[model samples]
Target: MLLKKERLNDILTDMAKQARVYVPVSPDANDGGGVGKSGKAKMTRFELYSPGTAPNFDLVNTTMPPKDMLFPQTQKMYRYGFDTEGNAYIDIIHDSDEVVIFGMRSCDARSIECMDDVFLSMGYDDEFYKQRREKLATVAIGCASVAETCFCDSMGLDPNAAPGADVQLSPGVDGQSYVVVAQSEKGQALVASWQPYLEDSTAETTQVSCALKVNGDGLKDKLEQMFDHPIWEQLSKKCLTCGTCTYVCPTCHCFDISQENKMKDGERFRCWDSCMFSAYSEMAGNHNPRPTKMPRVRQRFMHKLCFFEDRYGKTLCVGCGRCVEKCPVALDITMLIDDIQAADLSKAEEVA
Candidate 1:
């Protein structure tokens, strides 16, 4: 099926009636005035669709990943207060809403899959995350152009396809249309609902290639052996411990839980946290496992390359390159991968 670019607004309008439809709107295009925490223009974070919302389909990737749609940066778990008899009471906050995220790229879609493995798999299931995940549907768009920092292909992701997406929108043979393919029951229902907006047409999809490439073959194995390598010392020398990479990373799911109180009333919430921060691993007695930037930096990369793979059989990084593009310092992960590939494992083994 082909959905004409001109009729995108109509389609969004129709979808919005049943669910909250989110489209990729640039901050400049959004006069609605809700900037993200990064303080930069919310370049590509999915925003609620309005008639005036202008989605930038030409953009290679969004400045921030679409993880916020499922796992919010700050979520209130429950509210607590005391009764007149001094008995404590709790009110569970249920804020899940049906949502449709449109225009997500292949890498970002895969990031959601990574999140699912953590939130829904194993013997545990997070009720908060599961509620939102159950009600959300994704419509991923294939990339027609690649960013200089993007390395999704190197991370075992296809630039032109997202197998995990509910609905896949391929770049059409022409620039004004998208080839739609529904991959799930929900996606098929969505397609059926959008029948008025779609046309039956066959078109060839455009293939996209990333400019950046990293050899991730045996990367996890190599990282497992290079835990105490001196390469981390050199890499951590220039690091500012800014935590920008983890914040922008799609699959970095570290968070801290806390409570806010006013007199007797309080609310417990969870907010995103980064391993690069000095306080991230700090203990109550002031005993920090990763005291310096060296171990902290090593832990961050090792988690992305090794620990996650060890547990989930998949790398934590989706390689959308938001970290590569937004880092204040030139701490490139691609360079780290290259260095690891070229590192003397014999010497690392001897040191270990």
Candidate 2:
């Protein structure tokens, strides 16, 4: 099926009538200049599509990953309160809206697979994550242009395809349409609805390749033996421990659970957390094991490359380049991988 560029808004308008459609939005307006107060451009991110809202399909990738839709930054678990008769009541809160992520890239699609491992697999299922995952649909677009910092190909992802997405869209000839393929029942239903806007025609996809590449082969094995090595110390020296990398990462899923209370009611919630923060590892007795920046920095990278692979059979980093593009101090993960590949592990300590 070919989805023409001219009919995109109409298709979106039609889809929005049934579900909350999220598309990458870039506010590069005629007068807005797109710069936010933080000096960063009003960056591209998945936004809920409403009437008259413009979705930017030209963007390579969103600065903010779409992970927030599935696993929110601060999700209220439940509410508890005491009634006037002194009876305690509890209410479970689950906000599962039928949603579709349109125009997501392949890296974004893979990251959702990673989250599935953490939340829905391994003989355990989180009700909160399951609630959202079950109702969500993905429409991934093939990358026609690669960013300078993009390394998805090196991280074992295909830039031209998202196998996990329900529907895959790739730019067609002359950039006039998208070659759409439905890979699932949900995708079939979605594409069926777009039948009014699609054409029964065949077309070729515009292929693309990432400019940045890294040798990640054996990186996990090498890092396992180098945990106590001096490389971590060297890498930690320049890091400001700002946790910007985790915030912008597509696969970083660490979170902290807490609660907010009112006079007679309270709600438990979980918000995104960062291992780069010293307090994240603080014990109840104030015994901080990862008290210094060295261990904190080591934990972040080790989890991304080694620890996560050991548990999930895949690396956590999706190579979306959000961290690389947003990092204030130029602390790049590709550079770290390069360093680890070159490190001499002759006397490297055993895996911790």
Candidate 3:
């Protein structure tokens, strides 16, 4: 099946009529946004699609990941209050809507899978996250172009494939159409509804690959041995702890819960948090486990490369490179991986 490039908006519009469709949009067509056939990184973002939305399919990756569709930055878990008659009751805020994410790249899709492991797997489930996830459907548009920092392919992902996506749209070599394939039952229904905008023809998918490469093989083992190595100290010196990496990351899922109270009413909510902050480790006695930069930095990387994999059997990082592009101090995860792989663990162990 093929979806003509020109009819993308119409197809998206059709989907929007039934479900809330989110698309990768160029904030502005003339603002050096990722708008044309060949993608540019000026700025691309995911947003709710509506009439006149100029969906930029060529964007290699959005500055922001679509993980927010499932896990929002701030969510209201429930509302509690005492009635005028002094009756106490709690109102569970069940916010769920039929949503479809269109034009997410493979890495972003895999990030959702990582989130699924944390929120929906491991013998427990989060009702708030599950509610949103159950109602959401993914429509991934495979990458036809790669950003300079993209290393998703190197991190065990096909630039042209999305894990667990409902529908997959691989761009044509000529960038004029997309070869569409249904990857799930939900995808079948989605494709069926897109029949009017699709053509009963075939098109060759673009075989594009990321030029950036790194050897992630045995990275977890290498990181485990280098826990006490001086590399972390050296690396921590440059970190500003602004938490930009965690915010832009497609797979980072740390959060903190709190509440808002009025005279007789209150709302409990959870908001995104970052391990990079010193306050994250602060406890009742004011003793911070990861009080220093080195430990905090070490914790972040170790969790991403080793600890999560130990528990989930998958790397926490999907290698979307949002952190690499957005980090203020030029602290790059790929470089850290390279340094770890090249570190002399034998000598470090001897010193330890």
Candidate 4:
């Protein structure tokens, strides 16, 4: 089913009425008051307030991933209490909120898809993640403009095609609005229920702008070939071990689980973790497997590019380039791979 622009807004309003509607609405372009290049100015970061939390859908890409919606930064796992009568009880809080994420990019959607596989795996299924997954619905908007650091094309990811979205929208040729299409049963029901505002699909629906090359597969093979090379040490030298890359990445799924107690009453909690941390793989006896930065760096790529694929038949990276742009050392993964692929082996002897 297809929905026109006006119909889409009506559907959004209806969804909002039923549950919390989080759309991508652009923020105020100009600040209320600020100094210009002096006088101790309070500069603004547009990412500080994302449209993803707004009611209107008008922003480009959200600075942060939608993971916060599923795996919240801070959430209570369960509450416990004990009476003097010697009765103890624990109340586990399983989420039951309906959430709708609009204007999410295809890469971000794919990131969720990859995470579902991990979070829902047997022997360690996360109940919180499952609850969020059951209540969340994703609506993807195709990319009309590509960022310089974006290389989803190299990873064989299509910015215009979101296999994980319940509903997908592309800009129409007329440029007045979007050409929306439903990819899931939920989306079809949504369009059908909001049929009063929807319109028939037209020829213009096929004319969306193409996403640039991600080259993820090509880069994966090249990385595999150079796995044992010394490039990791050189590229990772300036790294601060901040773990910002994994935190921002859409498909990085490593996490740590810990239990907290308050005098006989306690709860277990799960939080985000990363390979960059020195304590990530440390054993109880003080034996650390991946103690060095280079090994940790190597582990990140290996897990995403090789190990994940072996398990799930697909690479974990979506080629969003968040790691490249957010790295403190200016370590661009794409540029790093490009440099490695183009490295001249023979030149080392002559230079020596």
Question: Residue 40 in candidate 1 has what lDDT?
Answer: 56
Q: State the lDDT at 274 in candidate 3.
A: 97
Worst 10 residues of 4 by lDDT: 43-52
User: What are the Cα lDDT values of the candidates?
Assistant: 0.90, 0.90, 0.88, 0.70
Off by over 4 Å in 3: 30-43
Clashing pairs for model 3 are: none
Error of 4 at 265 (Å): 2.1
Query: Clash totals for all models, in order?
Result: 0, 0, 0, 12
The predicted structure with the larger lDDT, 1 or 2, is 2
Give the residue spans of candidate 2 off by over 4 A. 30-41, 347-352
The residue-by-residue lDDT of candidate 2 on 51-126, one tens digit each, is: 7888888899898999999988898899999989989999999885899999999999999999999999999999
TM-score, each model? 0.96, 0.96, 0.95, 0.83
State how far residue 282 of model 3 sits from its true place (Å).
1.0
Q: State the lDDT of candidate 3 residue by residue for 145-210, as single tens digits.
A: 899999998889998898679999999988799999999989999999989888999988887788
Which residue pairs show collisions in model 1? none
What TM-score, to 2 decimals, does candidate 3 have?
0.95
How far does residue 43 in candidate 2 sit from its true spot (Å)?
A: 2.2
**TM-score, cand. 1 vs. native:** 0.96
Residue 307 miss distance in model 1 (angstroms): 0.8
**What lDDT score is found at residue 24 in candidate 3?**
86
